[model samples]
Target: MFRWYQRAQVCYVYLSDVSSSVLEGDSPTSLRRKPAIRKSKWFTRGWTLQELIALARVEFFSKEWNSLGDKQSVLLTLHERTGIAVRALEGSPMTIFTIEERMLWAKGRETTREEDAAYSLLDIFDIYMPLIYSKR
Candidate 1:
């Protein structure tokens, strides 16, 4: 899955609980609301951390699939909310960041399976480990 996302041209991030509500204001940015994007559940999943950093291009959509923005457009919001540097979010070489910093990204994320928290990081660290799955 990591390889697939890495080679893909662009990834679409769907915010199921978010909406592009229009709010009137004087500034030019007074078009689509930004608060909801910050509150999305997508950022809480452990798997999403690797998925987000691995991709070069990521397009965001609202609940109804409306064009919310792309990675470049919403870069600041993503950085502020995730505490991830812009360079990482921009798909820089993973080696640029220390292993400790990388690990911090997953510190508070939640994963369903016990092994999956570690599994999802294989791609992030460029470590290849065959997944051995068996029925419980």
Candidate 2:
């Protein structure tokens, strides 16, 4: 149940049984009619690079993203082609990863969660670059 108040009149909008009429030429429009559909910007904020990668990972692993349907495909493609694991960026505040940090995590050197927390940007790049780029 939703109730809205006007300066002189109170209007009650319900999910069912609504009727109204409008008169032209400086006449007031009755409240009983369907309200005009006001459209505003739906999705304005865009995802950061890291967020995109993370989302790709979810779509890839879950195999739920669809190009024609509600499914997404870009994220999964990036993961499959690159062999890099993407982590969820939901709770994290930082949107973009430094070049070195991206190299390390994406390359797979920081296998354990603990190691990821301990490394600096340079350290991560050094430890993970070889593993990620290895021929095998």
Candidate 3:
């Protein structure tokens, strides 16, 4: 359950299977409110092709990438979301970004070469790919 307190800019979320007293005297100043705008599960906001590609990269290539089948998983997820076919996603090496576009891709416009810094195609496929493509 979620309660919206507009005046205080506070939102109270009640999780299942826990004591309710924790929230008895809470105030917005005491709560950890994430500023990000979270989309509901039923809502898929419009996505530009570039945004999709960029997000795919980040989601697939996060750290812990070596834990499982990453690339294949991302391909499968892309296929499922797009119906473009896994083979095609994997086989086609279409350039997701051009050299000139790198600046735009940089995380927060930081032009750092540090591996942990900005955005790239390799990052996305390294993590969620296997889960997405696992043949069950």
Candidate 4:
């Protein structure tokens, strides 16, 4: 999956109320009052980290499919929301960052299966281990 993301030209299209409000006359505060991007299920998923890091390009769209901007325009908000460094969001190689650093970035993100919290990172960390379903 990580390899596919690296090789493929990926664009993330979000049906965002925030992007729509920004397009309209509403202030970011008004958008904030609605559901935040931070609270999004995509951001909280463990597997999403790899996709975010591996993809070189991403696009944001309004509910109506109007282009808001590229991912670069909102790095600060993404950093603030997800605890991910702007450098990471700006296409820095994940290899330059330490495992501990990556783990810290993932602190609050969750997975329905507890093991997936670690397993999702296997490719990001360039490590391989048997997926042991049993905790013991």
Candidate that scores best on lDDT: 1
Across 17-113, the per-residue lDDT of candidate 3 in tens digits comes to 2222332355541131111111112112122222333332322211222211233433444444443334334433334534344333332322224
For model 3, what is the alpha-carbon lDDT of residue 36?
11
Worst 10 residues of 4 by lDDT: 29-38
The runs of at least 3 residues in candidate 3 whose Cα sits more than 4 Å from the true structure, single-residue gaps closed, are 1-43, 54-56, 60-72, 85-136
Between candidates 1 and 2, the TM-score winner: 1
Give the 10-residue window scoring lowest on summed lDDT in candidate 2.
36-45
- TM-score rank order: 1, 4, 3, 2
Local accuracy of candidate 2 as per-residue lDDT tens digits, 1-136: 0011112132111212211212123543322111210110111112112223323122211112111111132333333333334332321222344655455444432323343333323232323332122243
Model 1 lDDT tens row, 1-136 = 6787889999899998886653235645423446668888889888888768878889988888887788888888888888777899988988888899888887788888878888888887889999876567
Candidate 3 vs candidate 4: the lDDT winner is 4
Rank all candidate structures by their lDDT, best first, as comma-separated numbers. 1, 4, 3, 2
Question: What lDDT does candidate 2 reach at residue 96?
Answer: 48
* Error in Å for residue 2 of model 4: 1.6
TM-score of 3: 0.22
- By lDDT, the better pick of 1 and 4 is 1
TM-score of each: 0.86, 0.19, 0.22, 0.71
Compare candidates 1 and 3 on lDDT and give the better one.
Answer: 1
In candidate 1, list every pair of residues with a backbone clash: none
